[model samples]
Target chain A: MAKRDTPMLDELLKGPYPSFVKELYKVQERKPMVQDLLGQLEDSYEERIGHWKHGGIVGVMGYGGGVIGRYSDLQEKYPAVAHFHTMRINQPAAWFYTSDALRTLADIWEKHGSGLTNMHGSTGDIVLLGCKTDDLEPCFADLTAAGFDLGGSGSCMRTPSCCLGKARCEWACYDTMKLCYEFTQEFQDELHRPAFPYKFKFKFSGCPNDCVASIARADMSLIGTWKDEIQVDQAAVADYAKGGMDIVSDVVMNCPSKCIKYNGNGIEIDDHECVHCMHCINAMPKALAPGKERGATILLGSKAPIMEGALLSSVLVPFIDLNDEDEIEDLKELIGNIWDFWDEHGRNRERVGELIQRVGMATFLDGIGLDPEPEMVSAPRDNPYIFFQDEEEEEDDE
Target chain B: MGTPSIPEIAEEMFQMVSESMGKKNLKAGDLTKAIRQKYPEVDRKTCKLALRELMDNGRCVYAYFGGSYIQLPHKEGAAND
Candidate 1:
């Protein structure tokens, strides 16, 4: 194949920031498919439209997902990249990896793919950008032999991801890595097969800080929290005072709930009013810490913009003991109930959040066998109108 | 009637796909519901296993027209474009 001119793409290389095109140029020598990829992208830029087409059946044997089929409409023009499909490989819990493991993946990709990879896709899968249909089974075989597997795709339970919890962060109240790995193992069938009306995602954050952004992205979000009062060390507070830290302006005034009072000597926090926002603790990490009683809050139905609009997760269970075995089983049963409801009632391509919105929240709660709690809503209804079931009408029907 | 075997379910699914080739697009959930309606003893897990067998044997393939659908593979000489 001859080199195609890509003036528009070439302009991107002129900037000071490191360019991916430059990296592709380096890999083009080993895998010539990169050259065709660049040429097609250049054509897309020129025409102001993408040339790639989706919707082909391609996967490893016995699997319905993990491989996304793609074809170039300009296949005749760029034959090398005519069948460049993508694969999503499941990442280890918390994305921890050894150098040897990474080398093994690189060797396998070099043998069967275009050698281009996204370190992690949006849903936390290691995305292999381009491969032929013929290479999929062999590549998957190599991956599984090395203790790796493909992540979920299509209408199934997507790869569960979490923040670095007890592994590194002190603010972590639960073992997020352990929970993520356990869920991934327990739901392997759902991960490998299409089992839902549409895609579902799970994300865990070690603390209410929500470093993983689960509240905005996941269908199910588990965020760590504590039940008791905040811990304070007066000596550390004295040291901060000696260092000339402005306790009133920086910590007290900054508390969203105004539950903190800065005495001339030390600071006091009203535990009753504290919403666990973690602002004061963040402002004075050395002087303050989370309480001993720790657990997680479960929220549900978050998603990206689609049929209705974007939505953040809503509080479902105010608090749950993640460390207790029986409590975990209860949580799993709740998850099962939620999936059953959505599978029976959801339309094609409808996310769980959209389904919840289509049916009133009360109906969804009733279907899942959960009682309505004050924490579920952000605010009470302003209007006084209420509808009650007529007991006389029900008695007559019976 | 006795519980339907995996191969039996796969055959039924293949026929469903064949009959609905161009008229309607069927999803995996749709096929599972239809199969369960026929054989009440078959569970969701077994239904999925049957679908897998159908794909592995090239009896049916998944097509993505806006969303995923189960359908028969294209015949020879047909243009994918």
Candidate 2:
């Protein structure tokens, strides 16, 4: 195939930051489809409109998701990218990968796809950019043979991802990677099938630091936290003081809850008021650590701007012992209850957060068999109006 | 009656969707609920599997009009050509 002119896209190659367009150009000789991709993208840029059309059904047999069908309106002009379907392969726990695994994936993609990829998509899947419908089955077969499977797409549970918690970070309160892997394994059917009212995502962050941005992204966000006091090393604190680290401005004053104070020689944290925000811990990593009674705080209904608007997840269960098997099972049961309620009540394309907004939080909690909790709200309502059901009226009706 | 097989459920789903085309926008959850109501023994997972079979066999397709709906192929907004 001859290289199509892409002057507009070529302009991207001259920037200070390394350009993906430049990378595509580098691989154009071996994989000619990338050149066509660039050409089509440049055409779209020139036209100020997207050339891709959605709503094509494409996937492996018995699976309802994982392959997103794409077709270009400019099919005749750019035949190479006419059917540029994308595949989302589930990434390994915490995105850990061997070079061999990566090479194998690349080899398969090169054989069956446009040799373009997003190392990881926004939902933490290995996004194989472009392929024809004919190649999808064989590509999936090859991937599954190599012990890799497709991630979720459509209105299903998206591939659950986590931060490298106990594996790398000191502040990690729980085994985030383990929980992520467990959820992925447990909900394999959900990942491969489109059954929900809208897409559901699970994200595990080791601590309130939320390295994975679970609070703003996931439908179910599990952030690590502790019920006990913050652990402190006074010797390390004195060392930080000796090194001229400003404990007052950096740690004490910066605490969102104002629970920490610099005591001239060391620092003291007010455990009850700490709020488990991880600010002080982050500031003095060597001197401070998370308490021993570690678990996770479950939050719910976060999403991008779709129906109601962008929303961060609200607190659901303020703290849960994820390490306990029974508690984990309880958590899974809670997830099922949540899905059942949403599937029955939610409209098409409406996210869980929007559904919660539509049906008052109280109703939602009741529907899911959970009692209202103080932690679920940031503050008590200031409004004088309170809708209440009288017990006498309820007894009479019954 | 015994629990409906996957193929049986798929056929039933195709009929329901084909009948509802242009009249009702039936989503996956709707089909699952309908199937469960009809069979009573068939679980949600089996219903999902049946829907997958229908789509895979080209008997039914997804139509995205604001949200995803199941419909016959070649229908308006159907995801199959």
Model 2 bad stretches (over 4 Å): A378-398, B1-8, B21-25, B36-46, B49-68, B71-81
Q: Residues A1-398, candidate 1, lDDT per residue (tens digit)?
A: 22668888888889999998888878887787888998999999999999888756677765667888887888888787888889999999889999999999999999999999999999999999999877989999999999999998888889999999999999998999999999999888778777688889999999989998898899999999999999999889888988999989989998988999988788899998888889888988999998989999998888988656888887888788899989998998898899888977889988888888788677788799887665675212122211223554588799
Against the hidden true structure, what lDDT does model 1 obtain?
A: 0.84
**Highest DockQ scorer:** 1
Question: Model 2, A171-268: lDDT tens per residue?
Answer: 88899999999999998877776778888999999999999999999998999999998999999999998998988988888887788878887788
Question: Which candidate's TM-score is highest?
Answer: 1
TM-score of chain B of each: 0.89, 0.88
